[model samples]
Target: ISRQKRTHKIILPCFIGGRSVSRAKSIVNKDGCYFDFPNDAIRILDAMTRSSRDERIVIGKPVLRKIPVGTKIQLPYHIVERNLHSVSIPIIKSNFIAPRQSTPKGLRFPLAAKAVVRSVVHKRSSGAVILDIASRGQLNDTLRRFSHMFARKLEGVYVQPMAKPGTELILGYVHDALMGDVYIAGIGGSFTEDVHDIGFYVGKPDLRGAKAMLAQLRHTSIITSIDVPFVAHQIVRLSRLIHRHPEIIELDLNPFIAYRRGGIAVDARIVTMQT
Candidate 1:
């Protein structure tokens, strides 16, 4: 009689979405076991494996190439006139008050009556000096005290109306090599980092989808009471803007004030892929 060979069965763990599912049997032969993964699962697995190697990895998005040094790039945050022209959103009226320039005799204040002044040390880089001025007297007093100290190193002062108090949120997007475009939304302001209340959506989301995403937030009541439909519309608009402009690599609208009737972007920063 011939001797019989025994075969051992092997089980492999499978993953659906992100969580690991129950182990499935693999095709076992005399030589080895073979595990097969669905096409969608393969993509997810690839992303998970490569995540450690990259910093800005977004699943379904393509990988980004290294940026070269000394490139002439444009940043959206600066108060320069050239940079301001690129932004489409309505901005608070602002001006560059020249350094060491003589103030006009009996000149009216440039900003509104109740407006606040934020004096950013207008160099290529520096910190901001914020002052709440309800009248001309306070404005002159604040500037007289601090202007001389920052005059040489600073560029100019920027004055704008004080934004109304409201629920703050952040809206932005990043270009993923594999995903194309990924939109990010979350609670903003000082609580942004502390709370970590954020959500991500791949590609553009319609109004209905945007509403659903917002509904998932823990602070849904606060958001809805302020104005859910208006905010959702703005998200859709932002998504379309990102899709139309490939040159825009990143967009950050922080402290987006959402009120009972509407909303406004308090601060905006955009980065372009220009050389």
Candidate 2:
């Protein structure tokens, strides 16, 4: 194929014997410049034939592979909260109590009675997830009823004070066999699927990386309402949790309520195996 004229942004500089291939890389003009491949024609043809395959074949990260497990246990929400708080991460105050009118100290009204279940993320068991308890009387009745109704299904009644309304998020990490620990941050809550955008960090996250993670979200109110540093710091801190607790295979903090000045992980699920 031949044409009278063709325009190019820049003719790619070539080197024959380590010399200036073109005058400052020939650029678009009235007439485009050309370079000669001064080599054996058979060799150039062979190289071109070999280069016909896909070039972008290799990527840097390790392949995601699931680890083989022996016996896994779903860590309770309170225990998860305690572990997270032990690392200076803020979590909503909660306690596991028997469902028999017993109360834990310093818990205020308008609480929630979340039944402890194994790896149940959503409202899989409708009645087990009860929220907005106005009084201790109501809480006790709800707990007792929950125990009676979902006896074998639940481990215990997890009571927590309702979190203040704010921007909700899902921040978590997964330690895989091949990929090691992959930290993630995203917009999540009841509206997780509504505008799903997640950012992943493979290495130890710094403030810059965490900021980029939060910036990838589509929700504008997340940036305007919550303290970005508070949330970004939360994401950066997950790297420590991964290192501190190697036994934890997966850690999920859903509905991470973010206020103007501070944020708290309202619910956490930590999956660990016996070590």
lDDT of 2 at 134: 93
Superposed Cα deviation of residue 158, candidate 2 (Å): 1.0
Candidate 1 wrong stretches, greater than 4 Å:
1-72, 76-90, 102-131, 141-153
Pairs in steric clash, model 2? none
The TM-score leader among the candidates is 2
What local lDDT score does residue 54 receive in model 1, on the 0 to 100 scale?
A: 25
Q: Estimate each model's TM-score.
A: 0.57, 0.67
Tens digit of lDDT per residue, candidate 2, span 122-167?
7424566777899878987887777787776555666788887888
Query: What C-alpha lDDT values do all the predictions have?
Result: 0.51, 0.63
Superposed by TM-score, candidate 2 places the C-alpha of residue 177 at a distance from the truth, in angstroms, of 4.3
Q: After superposition, how far is residue 127 of candidate 2 from its true place, in Å?
A: 3.7
lDDT of 1 by residue, 1-275 (tens): 01112322112222222111212221121222211223323433454444424222121111122223222123312222223233444445443343443333343443421111234413122334443456666666545654555655444444556676888887777877799888777897656777878777787889887776677678766766678888787778777666655566777677677889987775666665532
Backbone clash pairs in model 2 (N, Cα, C under 3 Å; residues 3+ apart or in different chains), count: 0
